[model samples]
Target: MSGERAQPVREQGTEQDADVDADAASTEPEADTDAEPAPVTNGAQSVVRALENAGVEYLFGVQGGAIMPVYDALFDSEMTHVTMAHEQGAAHAADAYGIVTGKPGVCLATSGPGATNLVTGIADADMDSDPLLALAGQVPTDFVGSDAFQETDTTGVTRPVTKQNYFAGDADSVGDLVGEAFALAERGRQGPTLVDLPKDVTQGETDHEPGPARTPDTYRPAERADESAVREAAEAFAASERPVILAGGGVIKAEASEELRRFAIEHEIPVVTTMPGIGAFPEDHDLSMEWAGMHGTGYANLALTMTDCMLAVGTRFDDRLTGGVETFAPDAEIIHVDIDAAEISKNVQADYGLVGDAKAVLDQLYEAVAPTPDADEWRAQCREWKEQYPMTYEAPDDEPLKPQFVVEAVDEATPDDTIVTTGVGQHQMWACQYWEFTEPRTWVSSHGLGAMGYGLPSAIGAKVAAPDREVVCFDGDGSFLMTCQELTVAVREELDITVFVLNNEFIGMVRQWQDGFYEGRHMASEYGWMPQFDTLAEAFGAQGFRIDDYDEVADTVEEALAYDGPSVVDVHVDPAENVYPMVPSGGDNGLFALSEDQL
Candidate 1:
């Protein structure tokens, strides 16, 4: 009755457990031994394998001569690699991917120009508290300090922006350095972490055995809210007549959607989200008022200005959000809660500052404040404002597709959980306005740095993070071309992502300002000579669909979504359509460009 499994255990170990011996004897040694071990690969290959083992399914980067060996290894590995048109695009893609997945996004870049290009994205992620791991390639170690070709001291360049950085001294340290980079990127008050691997280290051979993965010993978890602070905040909320909850990206980062919703409902307090915090509360909720900044909703701005108390969570009161420091919430008593202590009272003065994770803080507040059955008067006021200026777009009977219509159609066609990523431009604004985001971390874009060419590659990263979720990019024609080369990566990886190019043949946002403020001098904004995007997508082995008529938008989007793999909808939108209600740069939120009359 003894099984084949009995032999291996009996032979390998002491005969203490007969059942273990029986099971071990049942299994064949050759079959078990044939299993492939971790590859004894080069530093680059080991780096890629370590990422894969750590559950990093996607890495965004642009290929360069210095990093070609890494790319070769990445190509041969199982981890998904997304090639962006620019290093900035890769970094932004990594940032957005991390935001959506709650994991450290991996971005790769070569030294010198490549490393420099990632600076803005790195700063953006740092400012936003996003988790990102940047793998930068340096010149050969022999060329260090010599300023050889493509050599740059990336560690020095990125020290201020990253949580920590390391310069790989040899091949043996590459795997451990990468693991540390990931750990630092995700630990408390998350930010970008960098690892600069010299070309020699990447190509070098080492006889050292790859050690077992080491988790950080001093991993600092996000702080929980003190009961006393939560009680004070709750008491203030209970007492105020016009209390509002200002939710920010921190809420999304803390995954406090349920807690936020419950807290808002219990207290009958209206919720307002910052641009980056759009989906923190359900957009469909009666109390949800998205974006209360310079370009924010009029009612939300007015509410902030008139409110008695402001319960701020996960957001620093950025100048953009607070219409310059002087005029922002002049009448409100502010209570700021964030994981980062530095963010507390950095801009607008806070009456009470509580440093803690947003979800933990909100949970404590919910417990302290007993649920109010109703706030009919407050709800009515918020509803009235919502009814007055609901986000909308008119289907124009025109020659070219309208950006608003395209955004709305795409939003309607995609599933509720589908993630949307955007580039910076008129198209980014249009996506922000027209799309109804009901879930937190669903909408990802470069808000802090306002970097261009972020959409397509970010969508690629988003798709990689949530392979089961449909990811769509709202890209302007100019922005599309900025990182359009990434379409190849999507095609090659067979990522099922839909890129909706709002083809206006011009940098619409800049063109608008030029037309309105600069005496209509077109200058360098036009892109009429650009390649046909439909043809370009087809060339990349992806299905291409063009929308000429406004009526064809929904159908075109549907077709793109149904396509086997990556697809692009090059809709020729009207170049004249401007992102309106813009607060001119360095202008107050109160001084908005209302319409043609205001202009």
Candidate 2:
């Protein structure tokens, strides 16, 4: 009785008969085998589809729990995803890619610590005005304010750094939010933008398809300057005798380098580029004075200090470029042209403010001017200054190898179209001074943020953007040590980039500052120990080479450049050598010290 099946407690007893069972089963409904199946769609698929609609082909990010749904969606898409070792590296790679392509480069990270890791790179891109789009995963919607596991307010954290930020509230509208964020990142005065995605939203089902990426209807930017303002600025240019054309990074960003070059040559004005403005005008051109600022060429600095009229375009007039705002172009009446109207008089007051795109404004100004200014005397004087303070360094056979020599050796070995990247330090200065950049986007580095460990990861991104072109990076010993782990990413991707470490066993720039300003008190600047970078490179599966003497520079550089995969060249440089033509913080640019004694 215990093993027998229990019967239902019903009033009627069971009447089991084969005919009754068959008749009852025959009345039951049959499955509709020919009906169409439900469409497969989800919030994650919508996000990926939004990117596809924007023509995004590559993404740099790291996988984690909060962002797993998006990554799972990525598995079915054709877009290539690079799983970077760290979120910071992914951000930097995306930044560099944007710099190279002149478009918004995409990066992704999970919530909390993962999102926080991308802060430095985001700040760098924000400061430099590079186009970038960052996607950050968040905790489920219900757990938003509950101090849930791995939860962080990503939008709040990135609000100040991004041009704009959005919170994805639901599966139905998350894709549109992402599309808007992408569009805003590359809009006028391009900068980084962010979209925070919640796990629940990404995992939820959705049937709505996202439209093409677009900025908000209320967003609009001026693309042309007022005609009256352009004509007035042109009149100022024509009346001045000692005039100089100052090109900034914005010129390159707006693709106005050619327009800048033509304006400078047509008007017969000497050109001086800001550090970020390098390659806006060909350095080989007769009108090119190279660049100006702290540690800039002495001649270029002299020209800027003595200029009577300045046509400054697409520059923020940062403190580094203007050592002492009181003395910067003191005698010159400034005509500042920038896409962002806020930069018109923020740092250096402008006599004429032309707010528009760089190329369009340049063209309008060019049309307004009837004839060029008379500046032959000023041109001759600029040439004289170049001869007086040449950018040259001494390299003796018995002394330690000069970093300048290594830079020149590498530059000579590479092709003219090769791209160069650098980390923040003395090596960065050396690379800026020695290598001649002749094209826009060829020189990419952290300018405003001055972040260390930017070189290697940036090189990885640059290589990916322009695989046909050669990519080289100049990193200091201290800077290289900060992100040397990125070598593994480069090696794994088989990127063809050659990095030269100007190894002096110290934070060379800090040591130079300590010597000059702190009475030679060697603080924590000098490293007590340094690993053999050559062997370290080998461990990362990259080709390694070393140079201890001047004799080994050429061949070692050639060998490194010839390698099909990533390579690192550790060149032991003179520790005692220091960057000259220094304008001490807040000092007068006109009176820059040429040596420590002068300081």
Candidate 3:
């Protein structure tokens, strides 16, 4: 059975396969023409068919023994399978693909180490609420609890990080399980879902064909908020003097950026975004305060701190955004809107909680409000704050290059619509602060999980998802070293991704924290020795350029961006520099530190 080719069922006719079968039959002795043909479907074929039914076009995975059957089945399928350097890279690539395409990205891996390697990416997706689906090849069911070679409880290990997970019980039901997993990953408050495919099950034979992807009948998310709550919230907005709209990642995930922009502009309200919601509102807009939180714009923080009425859409009000909950919007009556009701008031208390789709709720508010708030004075104050605490940094010609300068140069070099991915660290903060993201889905990063090695692999995924668009990654020296090996994958695939390594010779963010909070005692944070990333990129068959001074930045950037395939620019930056506008953990957002002295 393993040697036999899968006779996959497709929505489109398989005339060519039938013709091939007829040609083979004409050359052989045929018998039993009157007898009905036997079913030839296997669990691996069913799994692939289920993805086909869901219209999945790309899959990221590493081939391994337990998963060989599925990979073999994929041989005849039309979907493009990307073989990544590691299971972790596969997961991150799939995650980025999902973010860029607004669909559930698929990743696959084998048992034990392979499954464990995908944990970080899975957790990252779960934290950021990105739609992703992971299929892990498992050991045979008979060896489930006997400590079999290369075996682990894959479902149990991933359960906490997934929206839902299933262990394929048998061949006949495995296909439907994959469909259900795909639907659950993409539906309602999107997050990662998983299905554990045992080797025996995938190798087992079955004739069942999974139908179109559909959520379980019991799964239904609210599409509209309660009318009474929206009316009262609208009334609260109308009566308030200082009104602000806080847009979070959910706004982008729900495709409600336009709706959010309309509501903020129509009501003449100030707009402040969460870091994850950077592109929800255009930064150049008069009402835009950029984003608010730790390392957020001082003006955005000041606005949120002083508002009388706050309408927060699609945000969980996480600790990074709120700082100290008691001090966060103390004088404001909060109207919290979210797709998941559980997220409402989970971190911060809400005076009015609206549970529904972000776009639907924004539309409801857009229609329900009778009179817009008179916020001329409030808007003036916001402008004044922006002027007072501008996002500024100095790059002296004699000194080492600044990370902010590098980020700005990249921003200038690339188009506004270019997608930017980042590995977690100080470099990520610099990218967030400097890059003017005018479009939704342009920014991708590891937010909640703060995984360091995400940038390069995500760049690969982003490039694959939008081949026509420029995909650039801003990665820290420490972060880049974690997954630099993925450069091989990018070079092999010929992906056009430009990576700028902010080489500061230290774990910049950790060193900053230690400087401020731990009496400047830098322990293991600083890297005493590091490789020349430009040379390393060349070793991996990529275009590599080194930037030691501001003089070389512009030309080097141009050369790197001009390369037809993967490129890396190693920008040596000030080791002493640190990210500022920092609110100490559990501190007030309004009193952000502009320097280490302030901290």
Q: Which stretches of model 2 miss by more than 4 angstroms?
A: 1-40
- TM-score ranking, high to low: 3, 2, 1
Rank the candidate models, highest lDDT first: 3, 2, 1
Backbone clash numbers for all candidates listed: 10, 0, 0
Candidate closer to the true structure by lDDT (higher is better), 1 or 2: 2
Winning model by TM-score: 3
TM-scores of all models? 0.86, 0.93, 0.94
Candidate 1 per-residue lDDT over residues 1-599, each given as its tens digit: 01111111002235667778778877946446566755645787767666766777767887787777677777656565666668887898899889889988999888899999989889889877899999999999899999798898899999998888899888887877788788778866778999998988988875444444444778665578777877787777777777889999888888888899998877778898898889998877778777777567766776676677899998988777886677777777898999888888888888878888888888888778754524567668877877776665555574556788888888888899989998888888888877888998799888877777888878877877787888898888888877787787677667788888888888888888898789889999986676778888999888899888877877788889998688988888777777666666546565556564475
Better of 1 and 2 by TM-score: 2
Better of 2 and 3 by TM-score: 3
Quickly count the clashes in candidate 1: 10
The TM-score of predicted model 3 comes to 0.94
lDDT of 3 by residue, 347-370 (tens): 988999999999999999999987
Give the clashing pairs for model 3: none
Task: Show where candidate 1 strays beyond 4 Å.
Answer: 1-53, 62-78, 82-86, 170-174, 200-222, 370-375, 393-400, 528-530, 586-593
Q: How far is candidate 1 from the true structure (C-alpha RMSD, Å)?
A: 8.4
